[model samples]
Target: MHLREVRSNQFKLLLIALLIILCMALAYRLLIVRKNLKIAQQADELQEQKSHLLEQQMALDSLSRQLKVAQQDNQEELRQKQSEYNQKAQEVELLKQQYIQQRQYLLRESTIYKKIQKSVSTPNPDHKELLTDKDWKAIYKCIDTMYPSLSERLVLAGITPTEKKYCYLSFFQLDSKLEAFLLNVNIDTPYKNRTRIRQKLKITGSEEKLYEHLALWG
Candidate 1:
């Protein structure tokens, strides 16, 4: 009986030892599962953070490219405006030069015209002695028949009689005024032909002096 009692107590101790070992194994397996789950969750969170950072980096790069493009456009626009301004300035300078040349040309033309007018309008003293009575009567008759309206004008100018030498008729223009009349009692033909006489009589005072002489004689 003593031996049996000892065996029974040993059996009870062994069973308790086995139960403790089993419980320890189960606790270790549960702890291992919980650790693996925590590691997986941390890995997922890290991946999400990496994706967000990458998206932010891409957005910043796009914005930088746009800024560069805008700056380049502004620079090109400024250059174009500067070029236009320079072209206008050159045109203005050219116009000013043209105006100056035109003004100078006009002044030169005006001076030449004034000199021509002065030369044509001056009277000759030598032509006064060539008139005569017969010449006057012939000129008066011719004027009355050809240009009656000029009689008053001719009378207003001075005319005198002298010895008759020759008789003639001529048509002439003086300062754009036309004269058609008979010229009487001249020593020599002052002009060789009709064209020459016309050209000579174009002298400014010739028409006025001739009219005056004819009026005095009449």
Candidate 2:
């Protein structure tokens, strides 16, 4: 009976030991599974963060490229405008030079014209002289060649019926108070030819002094 009791107790203790070891093994397996699950979750979160960072970097690079293109376009426009301004400035300078040269030439011609008129005219004349048809023709030709701008304004240029020594040069005025005015010029010079009379011809008016006249034969 004693040996039988001891065998029974030993069997009970072995069964308890086996039960404890099985419970311990189950707990350890649960802990390892939870750890592995947590590690997997962390890896998923890290991948998500890397994807977000990559999207932000791509956006930044696209914006940088757009900015560079915009800057290049603006710079190109600025260069084109600067080139146009330089070309306009050069054109204005050329026109200024031409104007200066034209002014000087007009001034020199005016001085020479006045001197020739004073030298050719006689102070007083004794006899009444009438201009011949040939003389009138030559005078008209000389005036047309010398004063084209004045000729453009001229309506009529002929010997005055009332005054034979003087000619009535009717002109149409533009942008002036008077619409038209007649200018009187002496044409009684000894010089008969167009070349000689061209140097002596003088035109004078109450509104404007046009040219010098020839008055030797009046």
CA lDDT of 70 in candidate 2?
A: 57
- Candidate 2, 101-171: lDDT as tens digits: 43333323332333323423433243333233554454444333333343333223332343221222211
* Deviation (Å) of 52 in candidate 2: 1.1
How well is each residue in 1-218 modelled by candidate 1, as lDDT tens digits?
99999999999999999999999999999988886576446445534544454465565555555555555678776565555555555655565455434333332333233333343455534444333465446444433433334445433432112111111222222222211112221423333333343333343444354333332232
Q: What's the residue-level lDDT of 14 in candidate 2?
A: 99
Give candidate 1's whole-model lDDT. Answer: 0.42
lDDT for each candidate structure: 0.42, 0.41
* Model 1 regions lying over 4 Å from their true place: 73-218
Those runs of model 2 whose alpha carbons end farther than 4 Å from true positions after fitting are: 73-218
